[model samples]
Target chain A: MNTLGISVDAWAAWAPGIDSPNDWNAWLAGDSCLDEGVKPNVSFVPPMYRRRLSLLGKMAVLTAQQCVDQYPIDSSLRLVFASRYGENARTVGILNNIVDDGSVSPAAFSLSVHNAIAGIFSIIHNATEPSVSVSAGQETFSAAWIEAEQILWSQMENADRVLLVYYDEPLTGDLTRFTDDIQIPFSISLMLSKSQSNGESICLQNKRALDSSDSSLNESKLNQPLSFLRLLLSPEQMISTTTSNWVWVKNSANA
Target chain B: MSDLIQEIKELIIEVLDLEDISPDEIVATEPLFVEGLGLDSIDALELGLALKNKYNVSIDAESEETKKHFSSVESLAAFVTSSR
Candidate 1:
């Protein structure tokens, strides 16, 4: 067990099928196939602010809002946004425009950056805190946890919570052949708190730990966040992941 | 009474992704930036491009006259109709 297990004040996830936390909870209980096509009603975001957001951006911001609304944290808490493939479709469109003509749309170029979704979140919440964006290949989720833990431990004085928002849509172009069976879009926001008593409030699979690989778990290689969801639903206190060299153990935070 | 003004309002709403806001809700004379609709310079560029594409009206972005045209739906309608 990693000594840096942070306390989760609240966590909210949104995908095509997982609309409400209740829906996720229901799915965890027992369900055959998750019914798809539940678009996030981002009416909470003002129309002006919603102008340039793609589907992935909307989902990330919406889920982040859901987590913050559930357990209100300080407005100045540091944020970490993670995604395996960031705005792939928009980038593809821009490239196609470049090939057709010699120019790309300014709006597309501005919003196609890796941190665009995080920037949009900051704008909506009026957050003035530091936000870090991460993209670590297939291990983006694991990288985010590490970053969140670092932020929490390093800023132990006034900074108690770090909001970790992770989201990704499928890659565009002919790259679909390489991706796993995750066809739907998804996002997750977890408010990680520093120095707290913990008992299964939040558990994580550590990436840096050697010999901690668990081969029994049937993991989806493309969608890394699904590993966390499966761990959340597991009856066992301890487990391992299939595709990665990580082990999930019970929370062992000492404060 | 100009249908062009109403059409311009609908175009603005559609171009800006102003969901849930009807064309009638947008006052014809309100300023488009800062206080009125809170649109930024980027939006100005976008709206200008959209206007050029849809109406074949070239907007001189650097000219102060362009600012006057983008001020409201009425102004944009007048400019588009006059230019064509």
Candidate 2:
């Protein structure tokens, strides 16, 4: 089977609500909170492309643009976007209006779909590339990454490359409190190529889930994105049997 | 007239998440883009939605003239007042 090596091209994160680790630590203790300056508004985004976008849309596009700028790729490359909760803010906002005022904003209604981010990306980038968005609840992280790897692996038979972008922002209101216990706002993109790695390579190792009483699987308190992130980006000393997201396979420097 | 501009300035500050900007510092004719306020395209989209929600003004974003209206908070307020 043909395998593809993936490397991190660019990652950008913007967290609106929390300003410090102390605030984030408080969130881990299960607190329904709001960050004073975390809300996404239009002034932060530029004017030429600001005519059509939501808060979530802005974040996704910015991260994707960052990736494109960092690594110049063919506009025809395939892409995969994954997000858990998938536009829950727009969902709840529409639901609130329907229940209270019997009306919904047209933009909000359209953006409520799961593929909205992918669609927006295709437009802003002016790329007619094939793309798909995925939402698999708690299994979102593993499923999305695995799918991207599989796509790259398949393309490697023809020596093709693909980009995988993973992004998720916590929803506003009380629901965020019930969900992510940490304020881990992040967006990570991995550009997978049939070519060999330069030095830092990320390897996706598949292993059987052991029968154990792990708090992550059982408790709703664990934030999957943050948990997976810590393990994925952890240093060698930080590696522990307790965490198993993915192992980084390091080899040579590009230079 | 200054009061209306001040009010619009406050609205811009609130909607755009401008942490350090004060209403008094925003001049009426200063550019709101790269030169003055340094807002980008994404901020325009979000703040446009916010303006619609707050003032009940119909922002025909599909039109090209909307660019001139967003040049400054003064123009935006004037546009809103005239449109109403």
TM-score of each: 0.83, 0.57
Model 2, position A29, has a per-residue lDDT of: 50
lDDT string, candidate 2, A63-175, tens digits:
56666776655654778888877778778888888898676666566667888878767766667777888887666765776776677667343325566666676677657
Return the lDDT, model 2, position B3: 76
Evaluated against the true structure, the overall lDDT of model 2 is 0.62
* Docking band of candidate 2: incorrect
Q: Any residue pairs clashing in model 1, and if so which?
A: none
Report the poorest 10 consecutive residues by lDDT, candidate 2 chain B. Answer: B12-21
Per-model DockQ = 0.48, 0.06
Candidate 1: segments with Cα more than 4 A from true spot: A20-32, A99-103, A155-157, A173-181, A195-222, A238-240, A252-255
lDDT of 2 by residue, B1-84 (tens): 677788889987776656567898888899998788777675677668777777778888788889899999889889878877
Clashes (candidate 1): 0
RMSD of 2: 8.3
Lowest lDDT sum, 10 consecutive residues, model 2 chain A, at A234-243
User: What is the Cα-based lDDT of residue A28 in candidate 1?
Assistant: 53
